[model samples]
Target: MLVAMALFALALERLIYWRVTHRRARRALIDAWIQRRDHVSWSALTLREVWTRELLARLRQPLPWLKLLVAVCPLLGLLGTVTGMIQVFDSLSLSDSGQARAMADGVARATLPTLVGMAVAVVGLLFVSRLEQIIRREDQRLHDRMARAVEDAHA
Candidate 1:
């Protein structure tokens, strides 16, 4: 649950970075760099490539952790299920007669954790997919703008 929340927050932050807050900053940086005559040889394609790499790195930084956590959620659920089953088996062995209630309770406990884990994983994955899409679009846009900035500088 906590991991899922963190992933959601990361997705929101990325959305704000590209859609709300960073546009002006990006344009200003590009303009300032282009206006500097001394930096002409730095070249537009070169600048674009550098910025693309940096932005891509920043954009992709959280993805591996997000994927790992999402993947682990299911395993955690499975662990809960296994533990619950063990409890059920233990209760059965200890009781001379069948402990139907105890077994049922254990089964419920086992299933609940798996369900919770899967739920968290599903939610996390949804956010991850959206974040990736946004990142890809933003990356392309950044590349396009940087290419134009390079051309403007040369012009």
Candidate 2:
């Protein structure tokens, strides 16, 4: 659970950072790319492609790991659940099986891990979805900006 939360925190921090810094980062990236250009052509499609490639390259660094972490969090919780159930079964096998109190306690213990795992999965899914939205919005903005740049250069 702690590991899952930590991963969520890291993902949220990066997503927020990107949201806050995107404009400056985009400008800097465009400037850098412009400087390295061997030829000049006001081709919006070409520029858009380059921007997409760059965006993918940048996002590739952290997005997959964030997704993996989010995905693993639920599995970890499931593992906990499985382990808890095993213990409950073991306890049941060793003792008087008719005690409602013992059975209830075991059931509670078994459910706690599953509940926690579900909660982590929900939280992780929220963060991952939000980050993907942010990335998609940024990509669209970059595409529009590149189109405008191409028009301005041609003019």
Kindly state the number of residue pairs that clash in model 2: 0
Q: Write the per-residue lDDT of candidate 1 for residues 96-145, one digit (tens) a residue.
A: 98878877877887788889889988988887887788778877877677
Query: What is candidate 2's lDDT per residue for 2-55, written digit by digit as tens?
Result: 767677778767776676665577887666554543324567447657877776
Worst 10 residues of 2 by lDDT: 32-41
Candidate 2 TM-score, true structure as reference? 0.74
Q: Tally clashing residue pairs in candidate 1.
A: 0
TM-score of each: 0.75, 0.74
Cα error, candidate 1, residue 125 (Å):
1.3
Q: What is the lDDT of residue 29 in candidate 1?
A: 58
The Cα error of candidate 1 at residue 2, in Å, is 5.4
Best candidate (score: lDDT): 1
